[model samples]
Target: MSPQLLSLVTLWAAAALYAIAMVAWSIRLSRVADERIQARQGAGAASSTTAEAAAPAKERVAVGGGDDAAVAAMASGATSFVVDDGDETDLPRRSGADRALGAARAAMYSGLLLHLVGLIARGLDSGHVPWSNMYEYTITGSFVAVAVFGIVQARRDWTFLGAGVTGFATIALGIGLTVLYAESTGLRPALQSFWLVIHVAIAIISTGVFIVAAVATTLQLLQYERTDGERELTGGAIRRLGIRVRNGLARWTQRATWFEAIPSAQKLEAVAFRLNAVGFVLWTFTVMAGAVWAEHAWGRYWGWDPKEVWSFVIWVLYAAYLHARTTQGWLGRRSAWLSIAAFVALIMNFTVVNLFFQGLHTYA
Candidate 1:
């Protein structure tokens, strides 16, 4: 078979694999959430039972009235929560899930291999590094997304994000193959510049980071929307969206246990906050580096180019998110919303700025 046909087949297969992984992950997360809720409720119920069982009898000791009060209080204290051995196992048995993680990592690696082949096939057809157009950008961006997720996953047990991230990578790959598919062609003078490396590398990394942050923030917001939506969660738009997702998840799971189980809003929020913080730092650097490249190429360090403006907007929005979360009382819901808002700006920066505004950074 021709290289082109081989690449197309590989791309489609990767998409299917990612979709499968996504579905499996969704089920796993839901199950884990159910488990968490059951565990907590069990603990609470046990504590309550212990308290009731330990209650002192109402029989009045012949001592002064104060003696009855003291006795009752002492009895309640005596039954206070005994630590059960099995309760400590609630941390989850990572060993049982090791094979799953191994499979996901294998899928990621296999997908990456095929992605390279597709990229190389396209490059062979184009006669260049394959970064000259939207099709190439999408493919490269997808590759970067998967690579970054894989690298990050290697260091920590963020496997919960596997379905979402892998699915995202697969979807991007599929979209690139289908919608953005094009005949590979050579670059002109305008495309042949060292600035391409500086600007586009920054853009690639920026896109990957923001996309990861978007996923994390999504998880955090969804978790919070279930438990205690913070004051900042008042915006009708987000609340409405959250309500829709909540309703769907409710229907999909059909059991109250699902809502009760997943990671706490606090934990998800921390993950999102940390990811966004790192993304924001990289974005800030991207903007700065792009500006420097802009000066070298166009003789202006700062111009109101659409891409430039949007980049700044994204940077500022995430900076504000980080700042708000830093406030004394803005730990959970409030901070999560800001993180969501930052991703919104990032989407706009990537899509709207590239398509609508015809400026120096219009390399969509």
Candidate 2:
């Protein structure tokens, strides 16, 4: 078979593997949620029982002239009436969810490997940079998102993000295969420079990082919005609709316990900020490299091409976001919103600018 066909087959196989991994993570998340619910109920029952037993034990000690050890024994189910001061006990048995999570993680790694193989095949087939069009961009971008998630997972047990990252990759690859698929072809005259490798590769990497940060920020927003549960607010139709929308989102989020497995809103916001910071720095270099390449290719360093203009807008917005997060007291929802808006702009730059806007960077 030809290299392009082989790459296509491998890419689809990778997408399927990603879909399976997503399912495994989803099952693990559901089991974890159930365990949390049961633990909460058990804790409530134990606390109530302890409170009742402590009351009578205190009365008994006061009337019969015994020590506090008797009260502790009464509450602790120790029939020997002895006080155990140490907190150590038998280790708690492991749950099935741990094993399931392990399986899910293994699946993700396998899928990631397959995804890389496909990208390599594509590069071999194309005989140039694989990310020369929307289809290639989506494939490479999705791969980077998964790769970043895997790197983060290596440092921390963020298996909770597995479902989201895999699901996003599956969807992106599906779109690339179905909607954005283009036959392997030669590059345009403007794209023939070596900067194509440096500029577009950095841009794709930054976009992928932004995608991961966007996922974190979105979850953070959903968590923040549901912090206090549903509330009845008095307002006009538009205001009420907004409230309804939030409530609806809260209801949808409740369907999966995976969101509960993530870190707190504060931590998630910090994660998003840090990731966006790295993305912003890389994006800055992408713009700089693009300018240098434009000078080489078009004999001008600064032209207000649609792509250049949007890239600048994205850079400025993220710069403001980082500044607000560091200097001003902007964090949590504010920083998250800023990050989301900037990601939206990045998407628009990729889609709207490439397809609709007339510019020097209209290779797509």
Full-model lDDT for every candidate: 0.70, 0.85
The TM-score of candidate 2 is 0.86
Clashing pairs in 2: none
Clash pairs of candidate 1? 33-261, 33-262, 37-261, 126-184
CA displacement after TM-score superposition, residue 343 of candidate 2 (Å): 0.6
lDDT (10s digit) by residue, model 1, range 1-364? 7766866777777676666666655555656665566678878887878866566655433333345444554555543222324335334446423545555666667777777787777677676776677778888877777777778878976667777788888778777888777775667566677767666777777678767767776766666544543233345897878666666654544344444434566776777777777777777778888788777778889988887887788788888888877865677767777777777887777667767889876655
The lDDT leader among the candidates is: 2
Q: Indicate the residue-level lDDT of 99 in model 2.
A: 71
Model 1 scores worst on lDDT over the 10 consecutive residues at 78-87
Question: Model 1 segments beyond 4 Å from truth?
Answer: 1-3, 30-102, 229-261, 327-329
